[model samples]
Target chain A: MSEAGEFDFIAQHLAPLSQGYEGAFGLTDDAAILADVPGLVITTDTMIQGVHFRKLEPWDLVARKALRVNLSDLAAMGADPHAVLLSITWPQAVRPAQMQRFVDGLKTDLEAFGIPLIGGDTTRGGELLVVTVTALGQCEHPLLRSGGEAGQDLYVSGTIGDAVLGLEVDTLAGLTGVHKAIVEDRHLLPTPRLKLGRELCGLASAALDVSDGLVADAGHLARASGVKAGIELDSIPLSSAAETWVRIQRDPIATLVKLITSGDDYELLFSAGPEKREEILAAAKRAGTHIARIGSLIEGKGVEVRTTSGELVRIDQAGFTHF
Target chain B: MSEAGEFDFIAQHLAPLSQGYEGAFGLTDDAAILADVPGLVITTDTMIQGVHFRKLEPWDLVARKALRVNLSDLAAMGADPHAVLLSITWPQAVRPAQMQRFVDGLKTDLEAFGIPLIGGDTTRGGELLVVTVTALGQCEHPLLRSGGEAGQDLYVSGTIGDAVLGLEVDTLAGLTGVHKAIVEDRHLLPTPRLKLGRELCGLASAALDVSDGLVADAGHLARASGVKAGIELDSIPLSSAAETWVRIQRDPIATLVKLITSGDDYELLFSAGPEKREEILAAAKRAGTHIARIGSLIEGKGVEVRTTSGELVRIDQAGFTHF
Candidate 1:
């Protein structure tokens, strides 16, 4: 028969998925009503096709990335995600199968994180597929980037630069086998350290998700706190595959610089007092996530990187810029 | 000499506007935090260039419409807007000046509505400019479309069909002066009847904002409440301009049918019990908005319309569909 109508499409594929969420009103009402909570943390992120991801990327991964990026923001704030509102602007070329796969991926991640897709809006746009997810989280005292003090130790959860390397591996022809697979997975899916983030609520003085380069994000934290950040080059964490690739490459320093400057890591970059180091480590151990002491907040302003030998490094470009 | 960077852009233009809102954290943190309210209402709406509005439209009106539509949803639920999260996917062609104008327009509405722009995402997309606004509102007891009963009186606030006619005026040639301006204003900028909506919370048994055609939206209310709505075609409220146009037109019945089928009214369509009619009228009077008793909900399914002479009318197209 004729193609399914808009209401029919939503009722068949989307409505059933939202049944358990009492506030969603079965997606029948104009807006969803949420009960009172202690505090609500809200973050929104928009991802565009071709600009944010390759057109050849699977729908599942695309959907997961869109949701995960917002979750990463919530994690940065040390909040537990409660629900999500998704807005999708589908490209004219998108088919029903593609839409189904995208929703399936979203549902998969929502279930994994225990966050319900409460409500959203779907519309038709131009050639690009634009997805925006507004994640609502709860935290009594949400972490702020401005909370860092001058003497705080800057730390990051999980290894960085794998996503950048993954992008390179996908674009380049030389990489192959397990190395490529690992980095590609990192690029396709980012693990938002929600548990560790919630655990770090009272521990981390300042926090943020690393979407831009490490130094750039550190600069943000430093500027917000009116302090300077000093990052030691040798202390920067790297994956085994990335280290192996760095060892094989001719210019190791340039590779390291690229790793530090490339964005899209999605790791929690935070700062805590030096006295809390043991507690931080204990929390990380409990969460089963690695923690790295990469830098320190100083008395001045901006971000400074120190070399392995003790020389201060001057960087030209710090991170990715959309405009 | 070089254009301001993304962070600089946000700091200079966006940060200052968000200073008054304590939860916004001056737009510096990863997410915005909101304190507890009695009840929370969330709504999201997406508008795309060309499809939703002409590219040539002024940035001020475009931004206003984008925000107002989401506010309309909150109003439909009898919620008072508290905060908004905006996600905009800007096209590459957008310049710094254009961006400033868009933000200025958004700021105007935020100030006017007394709602803060708490958080959002800005990214580059393809040719289309896609804007999504997620409004967070508060209400002790929100209105629902499913609350209407069989004997309830169906009433509509303000006027209908002006927006649709406005769209026609923009695309077609003929209309000029006040008529053109009135319809165009209705189409371009919608005033979210927030006061009236909040006032109707205890009075209106069922309520919704008319984004799609009246008959179709009435059908939605009908299906949600498991009752049939009977609308008197003659009772459909029309602006004086629209009424004048109807009187002058050769085929008035077709014009009226088209008006009823056209969408984007943004007026509140509600149902109330006959006993609460006086209270509803008083509420409308207090809110300073016109209310029209168009029909009643019957013990059946779907929506039916009767002509001035008592002849029943059938509509082929109920409402606008995206798919």
Candidate 2:
């Protein structure tokens, strides 16, 4: 087929998928018009096939991950996702069936999340499949990382370190059966805590999604708010599977440090006053998500970690970074 | 350098560039918050290294092209450029100096267009460099391709075919000096008709940008409006350099057809009633851009083109398409 056939493919498979959104203009216009938006929250993320996920991974899960990561950004801001724009570059060897499954995955997520595919661009000629999603959401009271006050207590939702540990299990084959499957699922698909984020809107002082490790992301919150975050290492929440793996490790302290520093945990890490601790816990419980108080913001700079034995721990690497 | 060092690079280079936009939150928050926007115009475009441009093309022009293409979409919607979010995937071999030059180019265009860098993501992977820019604009009254009526006249701004001819010149190495430079520049940097598009908001009933050739894009406008667009081949404007090349060609008719069907003009194409011709001409004059009446919308399906001798012309290939 000629390159122009790409338009035909989009018209056939993708245009109908966007029919639910009137602003999409049947996916025929150069731009999409969004009207009656109360407040717009914008976030974008790019995922490369080999770098972000294994090449053998299912196309549907790949699509879901691409969309959900951006959705996670919205959830961090206490926003309700409304629309998404995707820019994808497919490798020349990609088959039509793979493309169909990918679109199907996007359609499922758009329906499930109550967000519509509004607009996007597709191009050919990349060594790897590259998917970039720009998600737009609405928030009445959008949370900012800079909103954390010095006296506010830091809280995190969901267990940490499962994703990285899942990566290790998948790569090294060190774990067996259910434990491996559980952690691998955590690595493949992250739950975006959307309900918990929305519930924290007026409750939490500041919030962000923990994609780049708890300690590293906390440093961002600290720098933005001009306050230091003092985290208790022992207080960090861990999944039962991760705890089992750590207990078996020779140096449990080292394993715990690695867990706190490993990235790709798409949970909400936020701050609120100590007075509102009960309210925050109630909100998390109502949203059916776990909440743990792991730290407090203090008058200073950067992030500090304190071990259970009253010793300060030094971290060699805080989180994942792209260079 | 460790992956955590990427944060240092972003802080040193990108964060300072985004300081002008208050909503960006110094690029520290998980998402950017856009408040008090009238109506949002969202458009995204992805450019692959080899497919879109030569691999060795200057980094600055590549950056400009990536940003301008999406800005052209906003112009087609008659929206004022507001902000941009970029998602870039660099090859593993890319040097920091190269990255810096690329960002400098983005900085130049962002300042020139008064559009701030709101937020984005950068990753390391892909054999070829890929850049995707999502431009967000604001428009109280936006133009739509579906707004055209059957009796409206079709008009196009600037000259067509220069960009494709420029590509031919670059690849074939047949042209040299000034002519080569002009066509190459046309391909490298598309002048988005922002002022003219804004001026045409209420004057033109329907509008689009001619990135996929004059005919194919006009077909898009036709399909969206449920009307037939009959274009006069002789009326299509050509740059002086393009005219010179055509005059020297063995088969000028074929050349004209190729020129009209060639994509990447990046000029505004719109439809308006014949009664508003004077107003359209005046708007173009005020914007200091040339406007020409190419044809009219008729009662039918698809697009039709007539030669200067009043003979119907058949197009073999309508425009450039990505497979």
TM-score of each: 0.96, 0.96
What stretches of model 2 exceed 4 Å from their correct place? A1-8, A172-174, B1-5, B171-176
Error of 1 at A82 (Å): 0.4
Model 1 pairs in collision:
none
Candidate 2 lDDT tens digits, B1-323: 45556777677777887756887886778888875678788999888788777888888889999999999999999999988988888888888878888988988998899888888887776567778899999898899998999989999999999999888784534454787789878988999999999999998999999987898889889988999999998899988888878888888888888888888899999999999989999999998999999999999988899987889998877766555
Global CA lDDT of candidate 1, please? 0.86
Q: Where does candidate 2 clash, by residue pair?
A: none
* Native contact fraction, candidates in order: 0.80, 0.86
For model 1, how does the per-residue alpha-carbon lDDT over A185-295 read when each residue is reduced to its tens digit?
A: 999999998888998999999999898879788988998999999999889989888888777778887778788888899998999999999999999998889999998
Model 2: per-residue Cα lDDT at residue B25? 80
